[model samples]
Target: MRHRLYVPTAAAACLLLAIPASAAQPTPGAPGIGDSYYPTYGNGGYDVSHYDLRLKYQPEDDGLEGTATITATAKQDLSRFNLDFALDVDSVLVGGKKAGFAKTGDHELEITPSSALASGRSFTVVVRYRGTPSAVEASGFTGWLRTPDGGVAANEPESAWWWFPSNDHPLDKATYDVSVAVPDGTQAISNGTLQSSSSKLGWTRYNWRSSKPQATYLATLAVGRFDITTDTTADGLPVINAYSKDLGANDGAARASVERSIEVADWLGEVFGPYPFDALGGYVPNVPTGYALETQTRPFYSPRQFANGSNVSVVVHELAHQWYGDSVSLKDWRDIWVNEGFARYAQWLWSEKEGEGTAQELADYVYSQHPADDPFWTVKPGDPGPENQFHGAVYDRGAVALQALRNEVGDKDFFAILKQWPTQHRYGNASVADFRKFAEQVSGKRLTELFDTWLFTPSKPSALSARQAAVGTVKAPERPRSWKKIRATDSVHAHRH
Candidate 1:
């Protein structure tokens, strides 16, 4: 519940401008954040604090006109900086003045400011672009999905460049004010709370604001004919659910699925501390992305998956991610189990709460389901390869690992570790190493062997049995057929290896 907020002072800004760069003069910022899996995704030497994105969509041409104004503070003296962008750029302006820009490398938009930026100096860069927006293809699905009337922006990992210019990495968290204009009959929705909506001439614009520091991957923009419903949670947080009207007879069912997200959101607050944001909601689109993403306050869901009676548990998974993945993000792709494992465990916990099964029983099922030489057991959930980032090992096996830790440390320490992990690094970046250290610190127990056996080792071990023995015996309840479907469909269960 505690937050480390940074507020700029007038004196600080004045002092920063008065200072000068080193004798060598300013230099260009690094083109990437040095991530092991994605070294060229995010730029370094500057910290983005806010993004003001204005977009207008023309249905006639399927073209999107956009202007992005990014506010950031220089971490070092910089003559130039890079923004991850992949669109037809009209112009680039630095600090309200025209600046020279060029496209270099894969997705970098390098811009040289008119004047050198001193360390700690606050500055803004505006980029104007227009093009027929296209989604970045990956793993057989596109990040920014196109719809019948308009499109939905759900870029995970490294696809934000397909629509907007940004840092485009999970480590660089920034607040957002996204305004989108569409035709009078359509709707525009994004993250956070709806600030206002207005009509001018023949276009209607909806403005949204996410004041919390959010990673760019969680940023989203949905424009189309949607059934927008406004409500509030029991805790007073705003609820904004948007369902695609393309469902026709199933539109009501889709809307109900999104409304059910509030129940999961409310329950997640009780389990995983506060909700961590000012709002909670869901965006249901007809485009079947085959997966559900925890996109900030409003997660996007495929109509086929969400309205099929298994909505609550999956909603719980994504809402739990609001605390795990959104608030405390991963430092590298290898640490993705920290995001996925926590969510998978949340699914187990919710199912146990509903009397479907106990967390231990479910963990036991997944652990025993695979054969001794199965490749699923060979793939380390914590250190899966890039192609297998979302492998079942990362989910089912990851949950088994957490349950094993719980068995070793007892429920009191395990739940405490859960709450403390996110609260300690709220709205910040963390890694598997960070989680290991923090787990040991909070539980007052050394977890080196546990992590080694579960995360680093390629072969399955007897740890699951040892932990089960330590926890005593339990009856395995009958799992619902829906869970079987979850394992059957690639949406929830797919082994990459």
Candidate 2:
């Protein structure tokens, strides 16, 4: 049985009345968004536009010196602000002048600008620090880890603070210009297109620019002795695939996976609309990290993950995330299923396309593999606990939610949702509530029960039964359904603004 929801049109108007109108003096912005899972994840009252990160890393002793210059706009009258930074700070400057700063509660760098920043005013904060970078250990994994030769910064969730300071939340997406000076023998790589590299005085400085808007977590740097391979896609998009020199015999397999990433990018662009970023590539560093992450333009893979061979399925999964997780970010950490779920469904779609099995069969296999009493279902996919953000429920059950929605709506509408969802919210933040509204608006069918059963509820969703009830009872409103393909010619990158 599907539940019906009635959303009142005046809900926003009602909420606004609760806020008292006053010409109050400037005060500090809230330290956090009050996320249920990670309360102090992101700051309040301002939005970041760009991050200029300049870092000097010495791999011999793992010493790091960095200065992060953040440009942002104040969303409200504010006397003070906060940046999520875990590293040691030596000095702080606001708008090019010295500003008073002190390390506050967990990961918060409180700064008082030389003058109070008025509402809508833009400002810049620069922090210089030196330290041996540490990792945030959570969910039995660390965010940043050091390799035998160099280090890899994969700051997923909230680990970006460990390396550099910024608005660490996903909602505050910003363009990045990351320049790192490393030892002459080693190489440094981060997100976005390569800008320039110069070696002088026994140091090599590699500069990478992410012109597209990127969440801080998806911004990455891989520093090591690398076997660099650069090429171009059939469409002339530059590709740079870096493999760790430590992958002795596995270099061939790792390189093949990189080459295959180009093919998968083309295929996915055709099906999921155009590729979201300027370039496509990946890195296979033998870092001890047990998982692979979809870090914007260049995904990172651990050599251990491809032990069997070139795992094209993993390649497909991560590349799909370039469109899902990297481009269309989540509004809150609780909405992580928005990333994992979409990537899992994309893998299933690729499998179906390759004649392996239909998405239906894969969904059935996943559902049947776990009993209803398993912890996977106990944690809600949409709002899992902080420690359980990557629970199986978010991945498997999340995909099941999309499959159920597809079943309720036909194939045509389902594919349309996939393409439209990313296109509309490209390089921006969205929540489960936001997604629900968008799905309802696009499919013209009420999806209250469908999202409730698979996302918020603890019980395993019976896809066939629930979708059957939905399609049999509900009548979707008629609206003109059109698929508009957004090519590079039709759209401009959000960072351009």
Candidate 3:
């Protein structure tokens, strides 16, 4: 696997600094990355380029010790910066020199480097930390999934805080090289391809490399016993799927659904352009959680997703994110519709391909269930606040909004928008307004009212406009049970939705 690495040079570092001798003074980096909803989600003043995490885990006590080497570029002249972390730090190194460090907040590890970093100068921060990730909690929820045998680091919006120090948000994406040393029998799985594994003195170390840039939330570390399978698609793309050995009754069904990742990804490519990442696969961690996150090239699946038999719709949902969410992330968490909405719509597309239901039928059914007085219509999918970020309205009604857009713009431009959006914003972050503008640009249509009603407006879109008229027909069939099951899959905040 090939990765675009940032190799810093003295000349390059010197050229980045535009310090004036008269009025020169170094200052601390901002604690927050300027996110509106979650103000302090990620830190500012630096953009991470790559994270090399070398970790050692013991499943018995769920203890983890690791050294995280982060390569980043300074966006401004900075005296100090912060990394989101919860573990106990033993030492901190900046540019190979010991740095002054302290735990300022619940997850912020503030470090003042030995010397100020010049603007645009590439730098490295090495954090040596140890913690029980599964025990670390914030807001009364833990991101690490601790199973009987081992644990898995996988969650949305936040997870790296528990296992590794990072600029933990979707806004700052970076490639990862994860090396984990565990008991000889257990396997360590992570994002992208497994580079190599070697055992020494009662400990086995596995090395994994993710060549593609990924959000910190999407970077996963799972240490456990798994039945690993490897294959290739017809186009020769690598496929690697792993399942927990203790899945029990869910094993067969989970395998049946997740194993179809390559097939579903191939079909999604026909609609959404080529797959973004090099490796293609998913992992089932035997977790009882209800969510499945699109963790870069390798998504993390909860066993509950397949409890009711093979659920290919969920598979389609997560894999579609490889393009929509992983490849094209969000400018802010408020534009979660750009992720959940598109992923849900892809599930509808899958249902249509499988002869189960068309996107129109599914949209209408969702629209029918939520009446005029239903509070569901009050939540705007485009700018859903932090409280209702993962609301069903975002996934269900958001997709309905897309169906209306498809009808408003016609299939030609709608599909064009879907296929082109990823290409236009590949490996970058975009917002809902960005998507609306892209849609309007691609369709050559003025869709202000349509977007306002479906995305921005709070009340049920009752106005008899062209967008509503397109999906107002009352011929919706019985709601799919699998879709109902989807309502329960928002593990981040499933109860709130």
For model 1, the superposed segments whose C-alpha errors exceed 4 Å read: 1-21, 135-142, 248-253, 467-482, 485-497
Compose the digit string of candidate 1's lDDT tens values, residues 94-153.
Answer: 889999999886578999989988889999999999777653333344456777778877
Please write out the lDDT profile of model 2 over residues 1-497, one tens digit for every residue: 99998664697769767776444588897888666777787788899999999999988878889988989999888889888877789999988989889888757889888877788889888899877764443334445678888888875675587788888788889999999999999999888889999999999999999999998888898899998889888888889999999896667767777779888998888777889888779998877554778888999887755655565767777898888888998877888888888887777787777766667766666666676677777888889877778766677788878888888888888888888888999988888998889888988999998888889998765544454446552432222111010011011111110
* Ranking of models by TM-score: 3, 1, 2
The positional error of residue 67 in candidate 2, measured at the CA in angstroms, is: 1.8
Model 1 residue pairs with clashes: none
By TM-score, who's the top model here?
3
Check candidate 3 and list the clashing pairs: none
| C-alpha-based local distance difference test score of model 2 | 0.79
How much lDDT does candidate 1 score?
A: 0.81
User: For each candidate, what is the lDDT?
Assistant: 0.81, 0.79, 0.87
TM-score of each: 0.90, 0.87, 0.92
lDDT of 3 by residue, 86-115 (tens): 889999999999999999868889999988
Count clashing pairs, candidate 1.
0
Decide which is better by TM-score, 1 or 2.
1
